[model samples]
Target: MAVQQNKKSRSKRDMRRSHDALTGPTLSVDATSGEKHRRHHVTADGFYRGKKVIDTGSNE
Candidate 1:
C-alpha cells in the first residue's frame, strides 16, 4: 500500500487548499427583467441580456 512518507505541515496543507475554497456562481442582472441570473444564462422568464431569447408561453 502507498503511504505518505512525511507528515504534511498545517501551513503547507492550508496553503495548498487555499484555492480549493468554493466560490459562488457569477450572477448578472437581466436588463429586461431586472432580475439576477447566472452569467451567460437566460433568466427564468427566458430573457438573456436585454432581449427575449425563448418564449416561455406563460403569457397565455
Candidate 2:
C-alpha cells in the first residue's frame, strides 16, 4: 500500500478547505408579495418568479 510521504501543512490544508465552509442559502425577494425566498424556489405562498405555479389554497 502507498501512503503520503510527507504530512500536509496546516496552511495548505486550510486553503484547500476554504470552499468547504457552510454557506447560507441564497434568497431573493418575491416581485409581487415582496417576501423573501430562496432563489429558484417558490415562496411560502406558492409563488415562483413573480407568478403562481402551485396552488397552496391559502386565504391570504
**Model 1 residue pairs with clashes:** none
Candidate 2 structure lDDT: 0.92
Point out where model 1 deviates above 4 Å.
Answer: 58-60
lDDT string for model 2 (1-60, tens) is: 989999999999999999999989998989999999999988999999888999999668
**Candidate 1: worst-modelled 10 consecutive residues by lDDT:** 27-36
lDDT of 1 by residue, 18-57 (tens): 9999999998988887899999988999888788889998
Candidate lDDT values, in order: 0.90, 0.92
What TM-score does structure 1 among the candidates reach?
0.83
Which one wins on lDDT?
2
